[model samples]
Target: MSDIISVGFIEAESDATKCFRQLQYQNCPRPGAEVEIIQLAFIILGLEWNVVDVEKEYGIPPDMGTQINSTHWTGMMGLLSEEKITMVLAIYKIFLDITPERMKSVLFAFPSRYFQTIYVVRKPNETVSQNFIMNAFPSTVWIILAATFMIIWLIHILHAIIFCPKDSSIKKVFYQESGKSLMQLISANLRQTSELNSTGSLFVLNFLYLLAMIVILTYYQTAMFSNLVAPSYYKIPFRNRNELSARLLEGKVFMTDIKRRRPYCAYQCGDLYKALEKNPMKVRNTDAEVFRDISNNGVFQSKLDVNFIPSQFNWFSKRYDKIIIKDNLEVTHYTAFAFAKSQRKLRKKFDQALLKLLPAVEQITTAHGYRTRRRPFNPIQERHFFALSIREHFFQVFLIYIIGISLAFIIFLVEIFVYSKTFKNIATFLRLKT
Candidate 1:
């Protein structure tokens, strides 16, 4: 066993690096080194250790052998070139911008870990009623259906009104009955069939009425069932950067807030950064600003764009359902332990220790509880699990219920016109009670 070597670490406040700042540093000496999952392995491997505050001793750029902290893709290259620390404890890959210098400067220890990233989206500002109205009566399909039925009904009613035989009270009564029945059909209530008393067009009118109604009910039930059975989802999910750029060029979505945020990988990805910067997406600083555009109908407008985000933050934002990860736009950056050019033996020993501990570490941490493994990663989301509600799914059903109530009201109006005697009788009974 080598003597206690100085382990240097960078202190970052974000959730990604918070694990080292909290768990590992707490067990180590005062103002200890930043550590990662590999720390447990280092301890069990029987390696003596001394904590070195890299930030204070060497600075981020590392003045002497004191600093070993660099989280950037190329941070290790600069530190190793200067012979600051013998190895890097935690270096994350932003992208493989490797050059000849990196090739010669360091040896990589084994056990690279991967992370999952997702996009966060704002919620739509739609009420339950609005959602029902929007989903039930889709413009393109519903308008065409309503218009087609209206034209057919128009021809039927006009024959009774204008083209009826002159001096026929029966025809006049027929027109009134037909108009009232048609109104009920518009309100989407099909139980008014027994009230039809027109002679010639009775069978034809009933057939058309029921047929058009069947179409409407079929569509309504299908939509409601789809909403209830399958999970509610947006058809167009947020895709890769290229897809976003295309959407912007086509003016499908505009920026809402684009003040500087955390490191956006798109800046390193390609032309997407420039394209978006030309008309960068705007951002919402408050909840009201974020959801302002969502109130129009139930569909949330594509307002903000997240270029780079960790999965924990994305989950904590609770926008996973609305904004999805770019499944096809998988940009993975590799993270590896870094060792100095002369420390091949140490690097080889790290691989052996890692092989013995990584699987066990992952299992133990995961078994302790999900949060333990990802303790510092998504602290915000984990704490608020109790705040979740079924309303996220039930909003669709709630909207449908509101529609049903509105339809019932319209049907009530039609009933008063059709059954004038019953309403008058109720009024008289109410007066007697009063």
Candidate 2:
């Protein structure tokens, strides 16, 4: 029998190796049958394959070399565990945990791909235009204006209370009573004036404050109540692992590290460390498990309602259609194949074959979904809507117009009902007299 290499793969599909399979696969004879490229790479190096799928491990205790354990082995800790697999061909394992014992046992290879932080946020139902702080500046500015108006309103109220007479009655006109004083002060705040008995500083302060309040309030109301239509752009709620961790802390999202729990940052990123510290429960999830196909139509797993991925994923992004992959790159690391340290000769042979084949092998065209995808970039399936222009503030304003018309019609009916009742009462009274 040919030397069969049992390669570990994170099944349920969300692992980084899904893209690795995309790199290896070519012809599929039927649906749901996958032919991986790593499998081909091993075959190219003259090795038979035993693809071992990593099973889900929820509510299980930590194994040796785990983050929870006393050993320094982090991430998956053991790719060659159970002695079933001769090598680990995909996934980046940082050399931080590679101790002298590990160095003697297993050989780590060079990284093939660059990885960065890409956030998978819940696909929002509305446009993201004016959603971020750029869009929220209006509210902040309005709050400032309201603060300024409040100061002015307070000044006017004081002028009405202290400078103005408390009693309006002729008998008590000279005496300052608290009741009428408070009433006048409150009334000035609403009517935009202060009826002070004096004319110098008190009048000036009251006039300036009341005038400023009225102007600002009028402007604020105009902005708030106008037929103004704002455009919305699409945005995911969370960005980085820390933000997702915040959501997890707040119970806005959930994380499942059921398959492989020991993800002590492959690159030991400080931000990821902080995020993990903030939310220990926001465990990492494999991409395949998180995103799975359910229908003939390429709909992702409906149960994937994660408000955030809640953890960092060491992956690349060349195309971003739905989940926004920002330009900010994190945890720079290389990817390479791994083998037992004893198999130096075999590893060298594998490397030699990779040198000749990778450039050509990687040039595979994008045709079928999931087969040719890489990292964060995947071809988005196209859907059609019959000529509805969504580029600007079109539908948003139209919705406002519809709502306004509906309110107007309702008021008109109410007015008609009241007028008809008045007329009916008058006619009945006249008829009774006659």
Candidate 3:
């Protein structure tokens, strides 16, 4: 037994020498010297008595002195370089001694330890967490949707202002008639010439321009309101129009009235419209006033002459008996993206990061009480602005066409007059020469 145990130090020393060579150390210690140092360290550590006792108890082999001496060098060297050796030993100790439960606890407690080390090695440039990068920043899909809509609206406005006939006529009218010095014949007739014909066309052009501007502005405002403003104001968590409409009809939640009178707990604006349709009440106030009345009255009550529905009610009623809360409503799903700054490389990185994290975010959100069936990324639904409606678009286009044709006619008339004046001047010059 003594002979067998005495050879352990020699094996340890051999392994150390092998490691040193593999690491390409400039000045490797001799195995015998390392073993001597290890033995001294073990003695200091109070293991000398245990080693001697173990040797005596194990067996008898007087020739084991040579093996023991050789092995001593390996153990001594390991003890001398205990700092690095201890770490490696500790890993093995943990693997052997640590229970599965305790290992789990350690891992949970120090999750960031491993993550940060790996992050440093793999992604030195990334300081932000994946969670923040994927969730906190705007998504690329959303940004694209927003930008696309903005560009389309901007082009529409530009087309109306620059190439639209209504705008062109206004410019022509101002250039030809407003700043010109008029002859007595023209000046006398100008006031009598029923300026309504020309002035009306100009007025129509101006109206179209104003209308176009209003439409563009209203569309932008509505988009912003649905996307950002309404969310902040209503605090409704519905993802799409259907959900929103259902929430409204549910009649439990109140739509926010920032300024108007507060409605009843059970009623909404939709209910009031229904009540009014069933029996038109002359509430001496304007539409705004009607809203005020409903806000003050918490419940809709049928009076002999007037029926009142609370402004807070969300139910829809087409007729007295035909009241149905709409379950389906139209909603738009817009895609957008976000980034920390305008970094070209980071944009791609961000996109890849988002793709990886999207599933995780969705899982987390679902766990946190978000409705899994509802699409949370859809844009909020609201009433479309009148100007942005299809009818308004067509009307504006027709008005522009009429204005363009009228302006062309006026320009032709001006050209004819200028030519006649030039011809007269030339004739007078020829007569004088003759």
Candidate 4:
């Protein structure tokens, strides 16, 4: 009976002596099988392989029932896929004989790591391209606009300084002295005017100077009114802080306590009256009586006596007597937006967005009952109780001009009187000498 050979497996690097020992223990194959094992080792190591002439060359027995399998080859192929090995020599030797379809199948079965190497190999010129288009005209336009404004501003300043009454005060004084030098005149008059200090004269001079300023300012304001164009940007409707504070108190009627301090709040007297009436629970401090009197009287009555409460806890009410109490509240709307330099392509889109959003913003604000002014409060109507207040500035300027002309005439008369007296004295002395 033939002996059954059981193959023994060991680690790939096991020594030949170890293999022999294991084989001896197993009493595996006889001497002829040992020669076959040596031949199998040569075939597995790639030393030589010719299966067709195997019997002819070695005279080996046929069908020895020996089969050989190598796990090392399987592990090498797995490492190639995982490590993305793409050496040209390895490819030519291992994969050159493989069919194109079979090659593709093997490549597809690999993990993404193998494909990463394939992509780098195939597309050497691939890169990301970025496009940047910058529009610059809007900035240029703004620069031009700013320059134009500066030029116009310079011209207006020059005109105001050269022709405006306020700026010409010193020139007017110098011109009034006629041919006499100021120093000479002052020296001569020093003894005569000893009892009169320069302080009184200085005061009078300043008063006249301010009066001239008032006239010019009034004329400027009146001209703006008559033009109907209204210098919207330059015209500061309020004359001073007192008026501003008064209006702020008035806005307290509809505003929350916190809103009263806001820069844009109008604080009109009428609004203040209404606010006080609405919020009775709101504590009024020391100024409550004064606020009540102003609310009832529908007038600030006296600028000095005006009362102020903390905008948070206290508010001003609308005056019952004033038409604004029933009329549309006059408030100014100020709007601001960011603009890019000379960028016209996006200008329309940006403007459209603003127009769309502004209405919604206004709607939300209105829905919340936030009081916004339609236009600046008319000082004339409030102060004078008549449209005549609008023209008051014009009249005031005209009065100032009249006063100036009168003073000039009076000075002319004094010069004439002084000259006549000096000439008479000279003539009398000459006649006595002759």
lDDT (C-alpha, whole model) for all candidates: 0.50, 0.45, 0.31, 0.30
Measured against the true structure, the TM-scores of the candidates, in listed sequence, are 0.54, 0.42, 0.16, 0.19
Worst 10 residues of 3 by lDDT: 112-121
Candidate 4: stretches off by over 4 Å: 1-394, 417-434
lDDT of 2 at 325: 37
Candidate that beats the other on lDDT, 1 or 2, i.e. the better one = 1
Query: Scored by Cα lDDT, where does model 1 land?
Result: 0.50
Q: List the residue pairs that clash in candidate 1.
A: 125-294, 255-281, 255-282, 256-282, 256-283, 257-282, 257-283
In the range 1-434, model 2's lDDT, one tens digit per residue, is 22666555443333343343433344333211123445556668777666544333322222223443333343333545334356654322222233445554466554333334344433444543322212333877768856765665555455545544555553343233334444454555466354766478856765665666576556645553332234333334455555554554565554434344334244435654454466453233555544421111111211110112223221223333344333233344334556754557777777776676555433331233333343432222233322334443456557668988999899789868868988899899999999
Error of 1 at 105 (Å): 2.4
Q: In terms of TM-score, which candidate is stronger, 1 or 2?
A: 1
Models sorted by lDDT, best on top? 1, 2, 3, 4
Best by TM-score: 1
lDDT of 4 by residue, 100-174 (tens): 322322222111001000000000111111100111124574486456444433433343345446645755544
lDDT for 160 (candidate 4): 34
Q: Against the true structure, what is every candidate's RMSD? A: 10.8, 12.3, 31.5, 38.1
Clashes of 4: 32
Candidate 3 achieves a global lDDT of 0.31
State the local distance difference test value for candidate 4.
0.30
What is candidate 3's CA lDDT for residue 301?
22
Which stretches in model 2 have alpha-carbon errors above 4 Å?
A: 1-103, 114-203, 214-228, 231-237, 257-334, 339-368, 372-434
